[model samples]
Target: MKKRILVVDDEEGLRLLYKEELEDEGWDVELAASGEESLDKLEKDSIDLVLLDIKMPGMDGVEVLRRVKEKWKDLPVILCTAYPHYKHDFGTWASDAYITKSSDLTELKQTIRDILGKKP
Candidate 1:
């Protein structure tokens, strides 16, 4: 079965870009514009992984990460953020991987593969 990835980000362009890029890598991609919307999607979808953004309007990615970990402890979540400072924050420690956003998704893709590879 193809892996399904839920990408939660407020930026429309970044969401579309990630969807396109990840799709090309043969993974199913789902998008959510806000933390609230992502949570709603999570309840309805069978997501194999989540690529989450830190800075958002409401709830933010940190809160979402906490909630996801609480409910689905084994699900792999990669914190993809523009802000590098969040890496030092304790809130981000729960994520399976922490990656800074970039036009080049090589690192992100590799991280996803590495994390997913460990999953049964």
Candidate 2:
């Protein structure tokens, strides 16, 4: 079965964009507009990886990542943010990996593949 990925972001356009990109890379993609929506999806289905946006209105990605790691210790979460390290330490949030929002699409793809242990 193809690996399933959950792309979570408050911006509808970004969510759609990432979903399309991941789909093109042969991933089974799902989009969530908020942490609450993502939590709901987690309850209903299994996901292999999460492309999580750090900044959000309710329940930010850090909190969401914490929750995911708390309940499902092995769940792989890849954080995406435009913030500097001093603003928000994506690494401290217990994510498997991170790529700045400004990062190249190729970099993000490579990061995901590396974290998933697929030959990159």
> What's the distance in Å from true for residue 57, model 2?
0.6
TM-score of 2: 0.90
Error of 1 at 112 (Å): 0.7
Give the per-residue Cα lDDT of candidate 2 at 119. 24
Residue 41's lDDT in candidate 1: 95
Best of the candidates, TM-score: 1
- Model 1 compared with the native: what TM-score? 0.97
Tens digit per residue, CA lDDT, model 1, 2-120: 98999999999999999999999989999999999999999999999999999999889999999999999999999988889898999999999999888888999999988887788
Q: Please, what is the TM-score per model?
A: 0.97, 0.90
